[model samples]
Target: MAEREWTTADFDYDLPPELIAQEPVPERGTSRLLVVHRTPGTNPPREDLAFADLVGRIPPGDVLVVNSTRVRHARLLGRRPGGGPAEVLLLHPLTGDRWLAMGKPGSALRPGKQVLLGDELAIETLLVRDDGFREVRVVGADAATAIERFGRLPLPPYIARDPDQLDEARYQTVYADREGSVAAPTAGLHFTTELLDAVRARGVEVVALDLEVGPGTFRPVEAEDPRDHAMHEERFEIPDTVATAIAAARGRGAAVWAVGTTVVRALESAGEPDGTVRPGAASTRLMILPGYRFQVVNRLLTNFHLPRSTLLMLVAAFAGHETTMQAYHHAVARRYRFYSYGDAMCLI
Candidate 1:
């Protein structure tokens, strides 16, 4: 089948509500791993294993590419000037102190209006956008500082619980540095500092990239036809060190395993048609569906995603749709955790 002809239903699968993990497991590496092997004309049965066994699966000299984009406290509680409760989820920063944000009853916020974010924090609406988002300039304190004090962790709506103190650390990866993303890279959340050190000690090279996961990542694809879906561009960067590491790994015939879809998008976005990856920073709106040729990633590490979600489509593109769907069915039957803070999968 042609890549562009893929439909959203191609990625659809049933998931029981009880399987959706509302909270993370107490032990980071104690979560289960479902290893799916891909081969021509056959769906390989998944191997159930613990997360700690992941390092053993890595071939020597392989490069693990990870997205180090940190999750920011972007969910802010605020009020309209007249004191009505309001909520704002910052999508991305525009210019200066301005940001593109989605607010509850966002259409009610008119241009030039001021919203009180906290006791002393506020934002002045500069313009209303065509997409119903608001362009607002932060007031009273630096945007970062204010968010640190008042913003809550932007947990996925399905969690059904308030953000706890543990979330501030558990939700973030050990290597996170760039503070721009509102959502945590779920795949990276499984790795602790000790696990990373162990992987490195095994002679597996680890590299980092930056892809600020934007609000669009959480937005469900509304198009019945997957081709009609417009993927929102996210800013990403591939440092020289990481680029060099990938090149060296490929030269030695070692696999380049991406830690998550974010890393896959970043690497594939920077890769040439000839499969050579370059070092650079740019915006990527690339969408991966079945029959899409992969230029860089050889293996994928990811969490179970929502049904009919773009993330599920990307995994289907990596491993065949039939294989992925069957694995999902098995996961549901086994009652493995699903979604963010859920169980993981390794596709190779």
Candidate 2:
């Protein structure tokens, strides 16, 4: 039999509005974990467990890859040159003092228009791109300092509230180091320092890489056929040290576990046919739809994603479409928190 052609609708499931998590849990590693097994012929057994139980679930000597991209204070509150309310969501840097950003009240982004960022800094529009990004030049201060001093945390729109002090800490991972990403790698949010220590004690090698996650992570798949959707590109870096560790683990017959979809994209983009990754910095637009062969990651830990989302499609590719959909339906029935601040599912 030949493979079936799947559409965007085939990858979606019904999720209730109430299940969408508006806030993070009181503590890390306390969220529920749904373990989905990959058995080809039968309905896979999904064990509902706590996130802390992840240490026991993996075999020793496996390489655990995580994205250490830090979420920057990308949401900036500013005003137009005439004092009308203005907002800028910094996506990434372009050149010296210039950044790729999206602004509100599109009229405020005309060439040479200036948006006063704060008492110390302002941004002047340089150029606008077709994809809704504006090339703006910083004035009076560097981009980093301006964002740090006055920008607010760029929480996703579904949260239905402003970013508070609590989000300052809870929205990032414990090991987050590189300052780049606009959105949090939610899968990594479930981990705690104690849980990591426990995983290390179990003989698993934890490694990190940088993939500056972009706002595209929150976009839904609008095309009827998922193949028609254009995947977003993001920058990623895998150092030689992490590459050597991954090769050593694979040589020893150990599995490579990806902590989140962001890590999956980085690893697989650098992945070679032999399952070893090439260490270097690069940007990727790799879309992991069903039928795409995974080169590096063996086990995956990810959060519950939105319906008809690229993240959900990537999960379907890894865990089998039937199994992934089954897991989502089960999660809905069981009321597992959904989206960025939600519970997680581990596919083994």
lDDT of 2 by residue, 1-348 (tens): 897788999987888899999999999889999999977665547889999889999889998998898999988889986779988888899877789998788898877888897666887889988877799977898887888887899998889989898898989999999899999999999999999999999999999999999989989989998988989999999999889999998899999999999999999999998899999999999988989899899999999998899999999999999889988999999999998899999999
Can you give the TM-score per candidate against the true fold?
0.95, 0.96
Candidate 2: misplaced stretches above 4 Å?
Answer: 41-44
Model 1, span 1-348: residue lDDT tens:
433576787777877788999989998878999999887654446888999999999977999999999998998888887778878787788888889887776644678777787678887778887776789877888778768888898998888999999898888988999898988889999998899988998899998999998777777788999878878778999999988888888788999999999999999999967555889889999998888889888999999998878888899999989899989999899889998899999998
lDDT per prediction? 0.86, 0.91
Candidate 2 positional error at 61, Å: 0.8
- Measured by lDDT, the strongest candidate is 2
TM-score of 2: 0.96
**Candidate 2 lDDT trough over 10 residues, lowest sum:** 38-47
